[model samples]
Target: MGSYRWNWPILLADPYYGWIVSGFGNTCLIAVLAWSIAFPLGSAIGIARTTELRPLRLVGTIYVEVFRNIPLLAQMFLWYFVVPELLPQDWGHWVKRDMPYPQFLTSVLCLGLYTASRVAEQVRSGLEAIPRGQHHAGLAMGLTPAQVYRYVRLPVAYRIIIPSLTSDFLGVFKNSSLALTIGVLELTSQARQIEEYTFAAFEAFATATLLYCAVTGIVILAMRQVERRTRIPGTIAIGAQ
Candidate 1:
């Protein structure tokens, strides 16, 4: 029945402070590890989707559609709870009980694969943005399609898409909060834990919010520098502010 009181100092107290730090560390770890998976896998899928072969492209398309359409929280649950049961008995037991950091690994995998679908679309669009003339010229120069992608088309496409990829990269950090659903004890989960114990809901989550903003701010600055360096002449950055 009393007015809510703010206690900002509690955020700096011992275990609570450690929780925030650990949560921040886990958040960063998840985002980076997930991106490691998303970048290459998505890039490969995108490339596959763009190729002349119909079956390969179809497979890539299906992967994108399935992952993209489903909600991420559902994917997290499926990976952590359902996939283990689907595995063989011994392996399933190992995954559910004995695997190292199972929650962390599962969260990383689910988030990575989910983000990969979006990244695949980005990559596909980036590749398609290349002019047909370059593709034809590369072929005329006796370059294999793969070689053309390696030497000419991919280089330009990557440069053209750096800004877009930067957004995708930032998205991983925000999306990673969903890891809390799988008991990953990530940033958002830690914030909730702090609230449960201290009842300082505002302080706990305000700290988490500030931490997220700080991380994203750094990422934006770094990626902007990268985009500036990698920008191709005569091509405007697609989503520059």
Candidate 2:
């Protein structure tokens, strides 16, 4: 411990700092893009799972089960490597050789599809937690099945599941670190690079740990505010009571 030089200033200065900052930005960009894809896709699948249509429900169930059961790292590799090969030969070569930012694009798609499975389960749970009578009432009021879901069901269900969704959102940010495995150079990867260059593993990882905490802390506070604003009165959250 005595010989370990604490050179945070060195780490914070010049090309090193720039690399870490760039990596942080990439992490954020990947997480946001992935969540953008996951949310709507998950919502649709969740709704499908709850619908009376068996075929639609089966499709939704299969999607959620297959994605959720598979490991994320495996999915990432599949998206980056196997998927392009599975495409037509011309397209495969294009993706492998000509596609810009292939790793980044593959990371976004992999993370989005992987996270969508968990989000789908949360959404399905939220929708199903609503009283059965609510559905009947919506129908009785002359609303079409679609309208009942669009205007009546989804809004309430979303409110009920905001807390769970918040967790999923944070999960996206944390999981973005896994992009390092495929050469995205996200924060974790950058930290490793810094350690290699500077021999300051402690400083590198400590800085990363603080940045992660800061980001997730902000998310937690923001989500809490959303929960406060959107929470329904007299209704318990899914796991409570």
Candidate 3:
């Protein structure tokens, strides 16, 4: 360690800086895209798990169990390598070769599905946290079960789970680093590339560490604001905080 020289400026120098910037952008983009898929789908699955409908609950349970149990790295590999081959031959070929941004798209899908299972659980906890009286009151007012959820339950449940959802949102950003495995060229990938080119492993990764910390820190602060603003008085969400 005493003999090693640190070239911190290399990170801010030509090409390397650009790589960092674009990689950060890609990471953010992938997280946002995956969250788009995760939120609504996970909400539906969570609602299903709570519904009186047996088949819906069964299907939702299977989905959550299968996805949540599988390792995310394995899922990433399967989406990029195996899923394409499973399609019709021509379609497979297109997916593997002709498709634009295949790695990026695959990363988005893999992260989305993997994260949705966890989000479903958060939503379920949120739903269950609601007092039974609310559901009963809605029903007594002639609201269908679906209408009750659509109005009273869902709105309150979402607010109740804001902190949990914030955690999941942060997880998406961190998990996006795995996209580098399939060549999405996200932040981690760029840091590695910089290491390869300049042999400044410490500097490259140090910068990356700082950038990741900054981004996640910002996310935490922003989410806290959202949680505070959306928080319902006398709720478990606040009590837990």
Model 3 TM-score, 2 decimals: 0.95
Q: In angstroms, how far off is 134's CA in candidate 1? A: 0.4
Ranking by TM-score: 2, 1, 3
Give TM per candidate.
Answer: 0.96, 0.96, 0.95
Query: Candidate 1 residues 45-93, lDDT tens each?
Result: 9999999999999999999999999999999999999999999999999
Model 1's lDDT to the true fold?
0.92
Q: Candidate 2: which pairs clash?
A: none
Model 2, span 124-203: residue lDDT tens: 99999999899999999999999999989999999989988989989999999999999999999999999999988999
Candidate 2 runs further than 4 Å off: 236-241
The TM-score, computed over Cα atoms with residue i paired to residue i, of candidate 2 is 0.96
Where does candidate 1 clash, by residue pair?
Answer: none
lDDT tens digits, residues 67-128, model 3? 98888999999999999889999999889788988999999999999889989999999899
| Each prediction's RMSD to truth | 1.8, 2.1, 1.7
